[model samples]
Target: MKYVIILGDGMADEPIEELGGKTPLEYARTPVMDDLAGRSEVGLACTIPQGMKPGSDTANLAVLGCNPRQYYTGRSPLEALSIGVDMKEGDIAIRTNLVTLSEEEEAYEDKRILDHSSDEISTEDAAVLLEAVRKELEEDAYHFYVGTSYRHLLIWSKGSVTELTPPHDVLGQRAGDHLPAEEKLRAMQKKSYEILSKHPINLERKAKGLNPANSCWFWGAGTRPSLPSFEGKYHKKGAMISAVDLLKGIAVGTGMANIHVEGANGGLHTNYEGKAQAAADALLKDGFDFVYVHVEAPDEMGHQGSVEKKVQAIEYLDERVICPIREALDKAKEPYRLLVLPDHPTPIRVRTHTSDPIPYLLYDSEKELRRIGAYNEREARISGILVEQGYELIRKLFEN
Candidate 1:
């Protein structure tokens, strides 16, 4: 039987007053998901292990049936794999984001982190800005490589995996308070602001009223990673469709095929239909046993704290991604088991990842379960089917 997982990253949320006291999932128009909930096994799964940081790196590993405590080396290492960074022992990989910092403060420390994603700056423009930083700061020990959009990578030779706060976690907060404790890393970040704040790119962005990619925030530090092959462990030749590097890195490490779709940016306006079509092709034409489709729009909107956009993103996932994949499978007369869920909650209230158990829907094409209410946090919780171990949730999809 064919298997499919449609992951809406950070799709879960708490009740928002602006959303009429309903979470985005509850408030949004997700008719497709809501309809499937009637015949699907709907429940909650704790994607984040207890005490682990509620980041996508750890949660996704859990969702894919790999225990984070065992397989997760670090977040950047996974992205490094996607960037094709051949990390050596003792070398450290750090995520370098082209972020926006408040320009009012003369001292970099006093400035606030205005935007973690720098208004989701284009990768072409970001690459140019990163190149400038590379010329000024890159050395034999430290090197910068541009990834998707605002996400980039920094490989530090013989560097420590120092604790650094994610910029998204402290949005609208004093930048100095969250700077890395390591003096050298902190110094580099400070230097990055100096190099980018008054650059031509910043001036142009300012003219256009766009958040300037004015600083480099480093976080998610780690060494090289080693993950067991998905095919070997699950006996399914899997494929991954995602716009972000992190998911692609996981696919790289897990021996899964990374299906690239043109114009599939990790943003609200990304090509959702392209991702859906790619998954359908991988399963129907490529002879792949499993396909994991990840959509990042909901997570991005959640980080921006846009309640309306987050709701719209969920609707897009329902209409443009989930609906198309299901239609393609049914048209092909394929017996498939489809699983839908989020890795974790990037709550609109908190504007960051939360260690909350996310709701999930498991549907089999051949068999229909008893009807449940619409797919939302409340209904999933009411179903009384809680998977305490998130990694085991994947096993349930593969077996029976």
Candidate 2:
């Protein structure tokens, strides 16, 4: 039987006053997911382990059946793998985000963090800006590699896993308060701001009323990780379809195929239909037994605190990604087991990931459940089926 997992990153959210006390998932028009829930095993899966920070790196790893407690190392190492950076033992990888800082008439310590993603800047522009930083920062021990827009990588040879704050976690807060405690890393961050703020690309962005990719905020550090192959674990060929380097990296390290959809990007305006087409092709035509599809829009919109946009993202996922893949699998006459869920909740109020169990729908096309249901978080709560170990949920999906 074929298997597929659809993950809407940070899709679960708390009820917002703007949403009339309903989470974005409940208010969104997710007809496809809602329909599937009626015939699926609706439940809650705790993707983030207890005492673990609620990050997509940990949650997605668990959802893929890799226990983050056992196999997780750090977020940046997985991303390094996706970007083809062969990390040596003791080598540290850090997530370097090209963030925007407020240009207020105040000291740098008083300046607020305006944006974590710089308005989801284009990768082409981001690459150029990163090149400028690379010229300044690259040393024998440190090298900057450009990943997707706003998301970049820094390899610090023999570097320690320094604790640093994720820029998104401190949005609209004074940058100085959250600066890294490590002296060298903190100094480098300041130097990055100095170099990036004067670059022509940022100047042009400023002239166009766009957020400048002004500073490189470093965080999400760790040594390399080791994950067993997906095929070895599940005994089924698997493919991952996502625009996020972190997900792609996890697939790479797990011996799964990373399917790159041409127009796919990790943002609200990314290519949803293309990602759906890629997953469908992997299952129907490419002979893969399992496929994982991840969408970033829901999480990104949540971070931006846009209730309307978050709802729109969910509707778009249901319409463009989920529906198209379902149609393809149906047309191909494939008997498939489908799982739909979120890694964690990036509530609109918090604008960051939370350690909350997300609702999931597991559907088997051949053996349909006759329970009436809707696919949102509240409905899953009503179902009363809970999987405490999120990694084990994949076993349930793959088991006959």
Q: Write the per-residue lDDT of candidate 1 for residues 110-196, one digit (tens) a residue.
A: 999989999999999999999999999998999999899999999999999899899999999999899999888899999998899
Q: Tell me the spans in candidate 2 whose CA falls farther than 4 Å from its real position.
A: none
Best lDDT goes to which candidate? Answer: 1
lDDT of 2 by residue, 1-400 (tens): 7999999999999988877888999999888999999999999999999999999999999999999999998999999999999999879999999999987677667889989999999899999999988898789999899899899999999989877899988999999999989888888888888899889999999999999999999999999998999999789999999999999999999999999898788887889999999999899888999999999999999899889899999999999999999999989899999999999999999898899899999999999898886899999999989999999999889887
| Predicted structure 1: lDDT | 0.95
Per-model tally of clashing residue pairs: 0, 0
Candidate 1 matches the true fold with a TM-score of: 0.99
Model 2 weakest lDDT span, ten residues long: 102-111
Q: All candidates: CA RMSD in angstroms?
A: 0.7, 0.9
- Taken over the whole model, the C-alpha lDDT of each candidate is 0.95, 0.92
Task: List the lowest-lDDT window of 10 residues for candidate 1.
Answer: 105-114
Question: How does model 2 fare in lDDT?
Answer: 0.92
Off by over 4 Å in 1: none
